[model samples]
Target chain A: MTPEQFAARRQAGWAELESHLAQARRGALRSVPAADLQRFGVLYRHAASDLAIARRDFAGQPVTEYLNGLCGRAHPLIYRGRPVRPSALPRFYASGLPRAVRAAGPYVAASLALSVAGVLAGWLSVRLRPDLAATLIPDSLFDRMARGEVSGGIGDAPVAASLIIGNNVKVALLCFCGGVLLGIPTALTLLANGWVLGTLASSIHRDGIDYRFWAYIVPHGVIELSVIVLAGATGLMLGDAILRPGLLSRGDALIAVALRAVVLCVGVASLLVVAGLLEGFVSPSDLPTPAKYAIGAGSGVLLYSWLLLGGRTRRAAAPRLQLDAGG
Target chain B: MLPDLHEIRTADNVGIGYDPAGIGSRFLAFGVDTLVQGVVVIAALVVALALAPAGIAGTLAIALFLLVPLLVSVGYFAVAEALTAGRTPGKRALGLRVIRLDGGAPGLREALVRNIVRIIDLALGIGVVVMFFDRRSRRLGDLAAGTVVVREHRAPTAAAPPGLPPPILRTPDAGPAIDGVEHLGNAEWGALRTFLSRPGMAPDQRARLAAVIAERLCERLGLAPGAPERQWPPELLLERLYLQLLPRMAPAPPGHGMPV
Candidate 1:
C-alpha cells in the first residue's frame, strides 16, 4: 500500500480507539464479560501482530499473557474494539522487593559492623576515665542519668526494655524519611545516632552500670539494630534509583524508589513503635538478673526469627520469566 | 449435524511468536541488571562516606547527606506509579511496568496503598516464592500491591511478504459519519497510517481525520457532496467501502463505546 493509504487506515484505527477510550473514561463503557471463550481464545492464540495492530494500549507480551490468564481462555480479544477483559488486577508489590532486600544484605552487615566497632571504641575511651561521662554526656543530663532517672537508670531492666522500643521506632522513621534528600541525611542521621548509642553505652558502663551491658543489649539489640540498618539500606535504595534511573527517566526512577522507601519506612516504623512501647511500658522496673537475661535473649530470638520467617504467608508466587525454544 | 471438525478450525493460518531464551537467560539478565544497580549503589555510598568524618561526624554526614534522600526518592517511585504511569527503572528494564488492569496509569492513592503493602510481600520471606507458582509470576508484593510486571521487550519480527494486499479494515462505527464518500484517498490513508505508527497526536487533528478520509472516499466511491462540518465523513466513506469489496467487514457493534 502507498504511504497515504497506510496513513489513512492508521488514522481510522486510532480514531476508533480514542472514542472507545474516551467513552470508558466517562464511565459510558463497562468491562465485557468473559462469556465467549472461543472468540477471546482466538485473540490469545494469535496475539502477536494481530493484537498489536488492533490494540494501542497493549504494552508487551507479559500483558498479553496476563490478560489471557485472567480471561481464563486461550486469548483476550477486544470487545467493541476496546480492551474489555484484562488480566487480573495488576500486582503492585513486585516479588522482586525481597530480592532487592537480599541484594543489599552484605552492605547492611558492613554498615552495622562499622557501627559496632564505633561503639567499642567509644567504650574504651570511657574506660580510661569513668568520670568522662560528665564530659561527653551533658552535666544536667548526666546527673539525671547518673541517678537512674532516664528510662530506668542505665542498668534498670524495665528502663532498657522501654528504651529499646521507643528508640528503635524513632531511628526507623528517621532512616525512612531522611531519604527525601536522597539518602545523605538518613545515612548521617544513622551514623550520628549510632555514635551516640556507642558513647552512651560505654559511659554508662564506666559509671558502674554493670559490665552486663553486653547482656542488657544482646536481647533486643539484634532486632533494633537490624531495623535501623534496614532503614538505612532502604534509604540507599531510593538514592540509588535517583542517581541511576537506568531505563527509566530520572523522574520515573525517583518515584519508584520513593514508593519502595515508603513501604520500608512503614514497616520499620511499626517495629520502632512496638520497640518503644516495650521500653517505656515494659523495660523500666528492675527484674531478677536471670529474668532480665531471659527476657532480653528471648526478644532477640523472636524478632530476628520473625524477620526471617515472615514470608510463608498465603500470597501467590512471584513471577518468573522463562524462555523456551522457538516454534 | 456439524460438518467434519477438520473443516471448522485450521492451524495453518495461526501465527505464533515464541521466545527461546529459556529460564537461564532470563535469570542471567535479571542478575546482570541487579549487579549493575548494586555497583552504582555502592559507589554512591562510598562517595557519601568519604565526605563524612570517620567517627560520629562522618556517620552523621553520610546519613544527612546520603541516606535520607535515597529513601525519599524510593518513596517518590511509589507515588509516581500511583500518580503517573506505573513504572520504575528496574521495572522498565525488566521489560515490565505496572498499570491499572483496566487501563491508564494508577492514581496517587493507589500508589500509596500498593507501596504500603510491601510489608505483606515480606511475610515469612515466602513472598518471593509466590512467583514460582503464579501463572504470571506475581510475588506477594505484587499481590498485595495489586500490580503486575510484564516482559519489557520483544525480539524483532521477520519482514512481511512483498506484494500482499493491505489488510482490509472497516472504520470504527461509533464516530460521526461523513456523507458522499465511498473509499479512502491515497493521502488520507497515508496520513492515517502515519498517525497509527506514531504516538500522541492532538485531539482536534485526530477528530478531523475522518473528514479528510471522507473527502477521499467521495472521490473513490462517487458519492454525493456534503459539507465537511456535517457528521463524520470518514465513517460514511467506510460504510461505502464495506458495501463494495467486503460485505462481511462490518460486524455488529460490540457495544464497546464505553458504557452510558
Candidate 2:
C-alpha cells in the first residue's frame, strides 16, 4: 500500500496511543482509566507491529523513523520497573544489607587488612619518631590532643552530629565512587583515614591518656570505621568487576556489581547516621568511661551479629512463602 | 542523514531506535541540574534559618547549614531519577531520559549507582573526555550503571499523520509536452513526489533541490539539461512534470513519498 494510505489507516490509533502515553507520563499507566489502560496496551502492541512492518517495507523513510521513535517511547512504559512497595525500605535493611555484606566478605576482608596495615605503619612510625606526630596529624587536632581535650570542643551536639554525618557520608560516597578508577583511590582513602586514626591514638598515648581517649573514641569509632570499611569494600567490588569480569563484559560486570555495592553504600549511610548520633551524644557525655566502653562493645557486637545473621531466617523461609503464595 | 540511532530488539523481535544524547546536550543538562541543586540548597538553608528563633532553634539552623548542601548534592539526581522513572528535572526540561542498556526504565539501584559514580565522572572533566571516546556518548557513570541517556521523541502537537507531507497542487494541463515521461522509474517518481510534497522547506532550499532533481530527471529522460523548460522555476517545472507523470506511473510504494 502507499505510505499515505497506510498512515491514514493507522494514524488515529497512533494518535490515541500518543495521548495515552502523555497521560501516563504525567502520572502513570495506573492513573489512566481502566478501559483506557487496556486500550493503551492494545495500542502499544499494534504500534510495535506497525514499527516492524514499516522497518521491513519502508526502510529509510521518515515514517519508519517516526514509528521507531513511537515504539521506543512506549516500550519503557510498558516494561517499566515495578513500583516500590512501602515494605521495601524496611526489608532492605532487615535482609538486603546483610545479604550484600555476606556476599562481599572477601572484599571487605581485603579493605580491613589494608586499614590495619596502615594503622600499624602509622603507629610504629609515630612511636619511633615522636616528632612525626605534628606533621602526620592535623595541627588543630594534634594541639587538642596535646592539651588532653578529646571532644574536639564541639559546641552543639546536634550541629556536631549533622557535620559528622555529612562529612562521613561524603567520605563514604567518595570511597565507593573511587572504584571507577580501578579502586586504587578507594584503597588510598581507607589507608589515609586509618593512618590519621593511628597517629591520633599514638599522640594521645604519648600523654598517658590512652584509656581516656579510648572512652571517647570507641563508642562511635567502631560503627564509623566499620561503615567506612564497608564503603571501601563496595568500591573494591566495582574494581574487581573491571579487573576480572568472569563471563560478562566489563561494563556488564560493573553494572551487576554496582547494584549490590549501592545497596551496601545505602546501609553504610544509615550506619553512619547511627554512629554520628553516638559520637555527638554519648562519646563526649559525662558518663563513666566503663559505661562508654560498654556502649561501644555492645553496639559493635549487635551490629556485627545483625550483619552475619540478619537474613538467614528469611532466606530459609522463602520456599514456604512461595508455596503458600502458589497454593 | 538522521542523528546517530541505536536500535535494541524487544521481546517481540521488533527494533526500537534511540538517539543517545550527545556530549553538548548532556553538559547543558548537567549545568541545569547543578543550578537546580544550588537553588534547592540555598532555599533550604533560608527556610531553616528563618525558622530559627534563637536559643535551641539556632542549633537547628547550624545543623542545616552543615547538612543541607551535602544532602541535596548527593540525593537530588538519584532521588529525582528514581521517582521520575529516570528523568531529573533538568533532563525532563531538556527532553532527555536515562534508560538501561536493554531499553528499560532505570530503577532506584541504577539511579543510585550512576549518580554516586558521577562524583568521579565530574572530577577533572573525565566524564566529557570519556564520552568523546565512547560511541554511544556514555560517561563512566553510565558505563558502570549500564544506562544511557537518550533524546525523547516528542510527537508534534498537531495530530496530522507525519507521512502525509503537504499535498502538491494538481494542474495536469499546465504541463509542457514532456515526452518519455514513462522512462522515469519508481525511484525517480519518488524523488519528484518527495521534493514536491515535503513541508517546511525554505524557498531557496526547495528551489535548489528542485533544480538538482530536475536536472537529473532531464538527463535520464534524454532531454537537454539546459532545455527552455528549465527557465521556469525548478519547483514549478517539477510540479508540472509530476502531474503529467501521475497518470502513467504505477501507485507509489510505501517508501516512495516519504523523505528520509
Candidate 3:
C-alpha cells in the first residue's frame, strides 16, 4: 500500500491515542478517567503494531520516522511499572554505603592529600604575612579567634549540632558535586576548606591559644574533615571518568565511577553526622584538655579501624549491584 | 516475506520494543541543563555577594557563594527527575525522559543513580561521544544506572479491538484462470502464495519475478509466453495462479492494525 494510504488508515486512531497521551502528560495516567485508561492501553498497542509495520513494510519512508518518533515517546508511559517501596534508605546505610566507600578508597586518599595540601597552603599564606589573615578570615570571625573563642563562641549545643550537620553535609555534597565540573571545583573546594583551617591555626598560634584551638577542633575535626576529603575524592573519581576513562568510553566510565562516588557520599554523610555531634557537644564543652583529646583520639582510632578492617568480614565477592543505586 | 518479529516480552507478555531518543535531542537537553546550572551559579553568587555586608552573613555568604550552587545543581537534576516523572528542565524542554530498560517510569533511586552517573561518567563531553558506540544511544549514565532515554510520544496507539478487522487490508480479488493451476502440487502452490502475499519488493523486481514465474507456469501448462489471451500484468498472473490453485490458503493482508 502507498504511504499516504497507510497513514490515512491509521491517522484517526493515532489522533485519538495522541489526545489520551496528551491528557496523561498533563497528569499521571492513574489520574485519567477509568474509561480512557483502558482505551489508552489498547491504542498504545495498536500504535506499536503500526510502528512495526511502518518499519518493516515502509522502510525509509516518512511514516516510519513518524512511527519511530511516536513509539519512542509512548514506550515509557505504556510500560510504567509499580515503583518498589521507598524503604531502601536504612538498609543502604547499614551495609551498601560502607561497601561503596571502601571500593572508592583510592579516590578518598587523593581527596585527603588535596585537603592537606590546601591546609599547608593556608598556613604558609598566613605565616608569610600575618596581614593576609585580614582577607582570609572574616573580621568578626578573626576577632573571635584572636580573643581565644573559636568553637566556644557558638552557643547552644543541640542547635549548634544540627546547624553543623547541615553545614558540613552541604560542604561534602558540594565537594562531590564539584567533580561534575571536571574535578577542578572539587579540588578548589577542598583546598579552600583546608585554607580556612590553616588560617584558624595561625590565629591560635598568634593569640597563644593553641590549647583551646586543638581542644575545640580535635573532637570533631577528625571525622568532619575526613568525610569532606572523602567527598572530594568521590568528586575526583567522577571527574577522572571525564579526564581519563581508559578503555571504556567516557559514558561507561562515568556510570561506574558515579555509582561508586554516590555510594561514598552516603557513607560520608553518616560520618559527618557523627562529627557534627562532636562539634556541637564535645568541642565546646568545658571538659579538660586531656579528656577532650582522649575522646577525639579514641573516636578517630575506632572509626578508622572499622573502615579499614570492617569489610573483610563480609563476603569478598559482593556484587556491585548490592548498592543498587538504581533501586 | 514477513518481517522478523522482534518482540520485547515483558512479565505480562505485552511489550513493544522502543527506539532510543536520537542523540541530537539528548544533546540539546544537556545543553539546556548546563545553561540552567550556569544561571543558577550566577544568581547564587550575586545573592551571596549582596548579603555579604550583614554581620550574620559571614559564613552564610561563603555557604551561598561556594556551597549552595553545588547542591542546587545536583538537586536540580536529581530531585526534578526523581520526584517529577523522570524529567529535568532540559529533558522536559526537549521532550525526552529517563526510562527503565523495560520502558517504565524511572523511580527515585533510578533517577538518583542515573544523574549521579551523569555527573561522574558523562561529565565534560564524554556523553555525546559515547552515543555513537552504544546500541541504545545510551551514555555512560544510562548504562551505569540501567536506564535508557526515549523520546516522549504522547499518543497511545491502540491495538485492534476484538471482533473488528484491522484498519487496512489488501483487497482480495477473485482468482484468475484456474485451468492451469490444477497441474501444480500443493507445495508449489503454497510457495507461490507466500511469495505473492509478501510486500516491500521494488517494482522492477516484482515485475521481473512475475515475468519469470508466470513464464515458467505457462510453460508447465503448455501455454505460450506473452499470450494475448492471458491479458494481465506478470505479477498479477502469478498471484492469480496461486490464489486459484490454493483456495484454502488465505494470506494475511499487509495492514498493521490488528494481529490476525
lDDT of each: 0.45, 0.81, 0.67
Name the candidate that leads on TM-score.
2
In model 2, the runs with Cα more than 4 Å from the true position are A25-27, A139-155, A207-209, A314-327, B1-3, B164-192, B195-260
For residues B35-108, write the lDDT of model 2, one tens digit per residue: 99999888877877886668577776777688888878878988888888887878888889999888888888
Rank candidates by lDDT, best first. 2, 3, 1
lDDT of 2 by residue, A1-327 (tens): 545655766788788888887897532566778888788888888888888877765566667778888888888877766766767888888988898899899999999998987888777878999977778776766653443344545457778788788889988998998888899889999998888888878876886777878988899989999999999999999999999999998888988898878878877778898999898878877789999999999989999999999888633778898999999
Model 3 - which docking category? Answer: incorrect
Chain A TM-score of model 3 comes to 0.72
Tens-place lDDT digits, model 3, residues B27-130: 89989988988898888778877876665554456443654554665667776776656778898899777777656677655666666556545456677777
CAPRI tier of model 2: acceptable
- Lowest lDDT sum, 10 consecutive residues, model 1 chain A, at A72-81
Tell how far residue A182 is off in model 3, in angstroms.
Answer: 3.0
Q: Quote the RMSD, in angstroms, for model 1.
A: 19.0
Best by lDDT: 2
Chain B of candidate 3 achieves a TM-score of 0.59
TM-score of chain A of each: 0.55, 0.90, 0.72
- Answer with 2 or 3, whichever has the higher DockQ: 2
The sequence of per-residue lDDT tens digits that candidate 1 reaches over residues B88-152 is 44443554444433222444433554554343344454545666666545553444334444433
All candidates: TM-score = 0.39, 0.85, 0.57
